[model samples]
Target: MDTGKKVGDLFGRLGKVPGRGVGIGLQLLVGAGGLAYGVSQSMYTVEGGHRAIIFSRLGGVQNEVYAEGLHFRIPWFHYPIIYDIRSRPRSISSPTGSKDLQMVNISLRVLARPDAVALPRIYRQLGTDYDERVLPSICNEVLKSVVAKFNASQLITQRSQVSLLVRKELTERARDFNIILDDVAITELSFGKEYTAAVESKQVAQQEAQRAQFLVEKAKQERQQKIVQAEGEAQAALLLGDAVTKNPGYLKLRKIRAAQSIARTIAQSNNRAYLDANTLMLNLTDLGYDQGATRAGTSKK
Candidate 1:
C-alpha cells in the first residue's frame, strides 16, 4: 500500500509525462510548417503566355529559358525572372512635317512580342518592361523618317504605299532589339486646316471653269444655228426669182391666188373694203388685151 503524499507525487509525475509528449508533438508540427514554406519558396509555376529566366549569384544570367510547368531554383542563391511573352498592341503618335512642308499628324499601331529564345539577353539589357523601352523610340523614328519622304497629298492618295514602307522599316528596326513586331499600320492621318480649305477652293474653281466652258460651247452652237437659218432663206428666195424669170405665166397664177386670198379675207371681215382696179389683188387686165384695144381704136380712127 502507498502512502497519501506518495500517491500525490505519482499523479504529478504522470501529468508531466503527458505534457512532455504534447511539447514534442508541437515541435514536429512547427518543423513541418517550416519545410512547406521553404518548398513553396524554391519552386514556381510558369502559366500560359509567360516565360522564366534564371539568374545565379556566381553567373549573371543563364541562357536556358523555362517554359510553362514546375521549375525550381535554389532558395536565395538563384533568382527566377518571369516575363509575359504575349502579343500586345501599342500605339505611337507624333506630329511631323511632310516633304512639302505641311504639318501632319500621324498615328501608328503595332503588335509586339518578346523573342522567346532571346529572353535571357532581353532581361539582361531591357528587363521586364522591355516593350515599353523599345517600341516607342523606334516607332517615332520610323514615322518621322517615312513621313518626311512624302507630300501631304501623297500621304492621302498613296496611303497604302506609305503604310507598306512604315511596316517594312519598323519590322526591321524592332528585330534588332530582340523584339518581334507581328504587324504595323498607320491608324490615323490628318493635315492642317489651311491645307484642307485650299483643296476645297481648288475644287470650286475647277467646277466654275467647267461651267464657263459649257456656256461658251452653247453660244457657238447658237451662232451656227442663226447662220444656217439665214443661208436657207436666201437660197429659197433666189430659187423663187429664177422660177419667175423662166415662166411668164407664173405671175398671172400668183395674181389669181392673191385675188382669191383677198376676197376670202374681205368676206370674213365686218367692215366694207373698196379695192382699186390697179391694186395687186384686183388687177384683171392683161398686156395682150391692152394691145388689142389700142389696135381697134387706131383702125376706127
Candidate 2:
C-alpha cells in the first residue's frame, strides 16, 4: 500500500511540472541560439583600406582575396588574415662605409605598399611581418651598395642622386618580394667629427684665398690707373714743349691774351683802371713784343 501511495505521489508532482511541449520549445530555442552564434562567428568583415586572405586547415591558402566588405567562411576551420594596404612610411638609420673609407650615418624615409594582386604570394613568402622582415634587409643592402660608390663629401653633394639610386635598386629588389616602392628620401647625412672639422677648415682657407685674390686684383687696377694718369700728364708736357719750340710767337700771343683778360677783369671791378693804347704798346716791348714782330716778318718774307 505504501509503494502505491509513493508512486501516486510521484505522478502527482510530475503533473504539476511543465508539459513536454514546453521542454521541446526550450530545447529548440537553445539550439537556435547556438546556430545563430555559429553563423555570426562564420561571418567576417573587412574594413576599408584593408584586405584579407583566407587560410584553410584542409586546403591551404585560398587564392582569392576579400576586399572591404562582408565575407563568409567555414567556422572553426578557415581563418582570415587581414593586411593594411595603405601607403606606409618607415624610417631607417644605417651606418655605412663610403668609397673613401669614411664612416657615414644615413637617415632615410621610405614609402612602400604591397601589391594587392600578389598579396597571397607575399603572405606565403614573407607573412604579415613584411616591414620588419623584408624591408630592413633590402633597404640596408641597397643603401650600403649605393653609399659605397660615393665618397663622404660626395654623399652630401650628391644626396639626391644617391637617394634616387637607392629607390631604383630597392624598387627592383622589393618587386621580387611582392612589394611596391613608391618613393625614398635621404633625410640626414652625417660624418665623423674629424671630417666636419676638416671641412670647416678647408672652407675657411678657400674664403681667405678668395679675399687675397680680390685684394691683388684691386692693387693691379690701381697701379694701372696711376700709370695711365702719368702717361696723360707726360703727353700734355711734351705737347706744350713742342708748341713752344715750333712757334716762338706762341708765348707772346699767350702773354697778350693774359693781359687782355686782366684788363677785362679790371674794367668789371668797382675800382677800374684805364690804360691808353700807347701805354699798352709800351708794355708790349717788355713782354717779348719783338719776338712776335720778328716771327711775323719771317712769315711775310
Candidate 3:
C-alpha cells in the first residue's frame, strides 16, 4: 500500500512539472509583447491594385515600392504608405466665356497609372496627395496654356488638336510626378449662343444652295429631252421623204386614197356612189358626142 501511494505521489509531481513549465513559458511570452508587436508590424500585405512606399525619417530610403502580396520591413523604423497603381481618370469643366475675353468650354478625360519603379522618388518629391496635387496641377496648367493659343471658335472647332497638345505637354510634365499618362481626350466642346446660331444659319444656306442646284439640273434635263424629241422627228421626216423619192407612185396612191377616204366619209350608207356636179356634167358631154357620131355615119351609108 505504501509503495502504491509513493507511485501516485511521483506521478502527481511529474504532472506539476509540466504545469510549472507551461506557466513560466507563458509568462516569458507575455513579457515580450512589445517585441512581438514590432515583429508583426514588420510584415504586411500590399494587396492587388496597390503599391506601397516605405517612408522613413531618413531621406529617400533605398528600398521602396512593395509589389502586391506579403512584404517585410524593419519594425518602428519603416512604415508603408500604399498608393493605388491602377488606371484612373480625372476631368474638369471648361472656363466660362467673357466679353473682352471669349472663352470655350472644355472637358478633359485623362488616364493615369503610377510609376511602380519610381515610387520612392515620387513619395519623396511629390508626397502622398498625388491625385489632388500632381494630377490636377498638371492638367490645369497644360489645359490653360494650350487653350490660350487659340480663339474660342477655333478652340471649339479644333478641340482634338488641342487635346493632343494637352496630352503631349502633360506627358512631358508627368515625368516629375512619377505617373504615366496613357490617354487624354477633350470629350466636350461648346461655343456661345451667337456663334451657335451663326453656324446653324450657315448650314441652312448650304442646304438651300444644294436644293437650288438640284432644281437647275432637273430643268436642264427637261430641255435636253425636248431637243432630243425634235431631232428624232426631223430624222423621221427625212426618212419618209427618201421613201417617197424612191417610189413616185406613192404620192399618186396617197392622193387617190385621200379622195376615196373623203368619199367614204360623205357616203356613210355602204354601196351608194355619190358624184359631184362637175363629174355629172363631164359624163353628159361624152354621151352627146357619141350620139352625133352614130347619126352622121348612118346618113353617109
Candidate 4:
C-alpha cells in the first residue's frame, strides 16, 4: 500500500510538469514571433566607400542619397541602392579617321569618380550602369567632335591635344551623370596595314634624304678644307720667296741644286752642258761693261 501511494504521487507530479511544458511552449512561440517582427521591421546599415540611392516604390525621383556609413530604412517598403564611389576605369572605342577616309581605331582610358552629392540625381536619370549609358555616350560624342577637327597625321602626332579635347568635352558632358573625369588618355591607335606601310616608306625616304644631305655637307666641307689648304700653301710659298730674296745665299744654293738636277738630266742626253761659276761671273761682268760704255758715250755726246 505504501509503494502504491508513492506511484500515485509520481503520476500527479508528471501531470503538473506537462501543464508547465504547455505554458512554456506558448511563451517560446510568442518570443519567436516578436523577434521575427523586430528583425523584419529593423533598419539595415550601409558602410563607407559606398553610396546609396533611395528609390521610391511609387516610381519617380530618388531625392535622398546615403554616403559612406550606417543608414536605416523600412525593410519591406524602402530599400537602398548601393553604388561604388571609388575610382574606376572606363574605355571608349571609336572608328575614327582623317579627312582622307583612312579608317583608324581610337581608344581612350578614362579615370572617373562618382560625385557623392549628385548620386541621387545621377541614379534617377543615368542609373547604376553609368559606364554603358553615360560613359560610352560621352566618349563617342567627344571623340567624334575632336576627330573632326584634325587630320590623321595631326591626330597621331598631337595626341596630347586630342586627349585634352576629350577630357574637356567629356567632363562637361558628364556633369549630369555625377562623374568626375580625372584623366582621359589616348592609349591605343591602330592604322590599316596599307597605311602603316605607307608611313614606314615615307619615314624611310625621309631618313635617306637626311643621309644624303649629311653626305653632301661632308663633301662640301672637305672641298673647302682642300681649297683653304692650297691657299695656305700658296701664302707660305710667297713668304718663303720673300725670305729667300732677303737672304743672298738662299738663291745661290737653290740655283746650284737646280743646275745639278739639270746636269743629271742632260747626262742621259746628247746635249752638251757646261756648269762654270767663273764663266757665269765673266758674262755678268761683260753685260755691265756694255751698259757702262753706252752710258759714258751718251754723256760725252
lDDT scores of the candidates, listed in order: 0.88, 0.87, 0.76, 0.77
In the range 146-230, model 3's lDDT, one tens digit per residue, is 8778877667667678777888998999877778988888888776677778779999999999999999999999999999999
Q: Tens-digit lDDT track for model 1 on 1-301?
A: 4698899999999989999999999999999998998898899899999999999998879999999999998888898888888989998998999999999999999999999999999988898899889898999899999999999989999999999999999999998989998888889998889988998999999999999999999999999999999999999888866655565455567778988898898889999888776664555576764465456445544
Residue 166 displacement (Å), model 2: 1.0
Record all residue pairs in model 4 with backbone atoms less than 3 Å apart, i.e. clashing. Answer: none
lDDT of 2 by residue, 107-188 (tens): 8899888888888888888899888898898889998999999999888888888888988898999888888878888888
Q: On lDDT, who's better, 1 or 3?
A: 1
Model 1 lowest lDDT segment of ten: 292-301
Query: Who is ahead in TM-score, 3 or 4?
Result: 4
Off by over 4 Å in 4: 1-23, 29-37, 56-62, 234-248, 251-301
Score residue 240 of candidate 2 by CA lDDT.
Answer: 69
Candidate 3 stretches with Cα past 4 Å from truth are 1-26, 32-35, 57-69, 95-103, 147-163, 238-301
TM-score each candidate. 0.72, 0.73, 0.60, 0.67
Q: Write the per-residue lDDT of candidate 4 for residues 90-153, one digit (tens) a residue.
A: 8778987666777778988998888988887777677888767778877887787778787778
Looking at model 2, the pairs that clash are: none
Model 2 per-residue lDDT at 92: 92
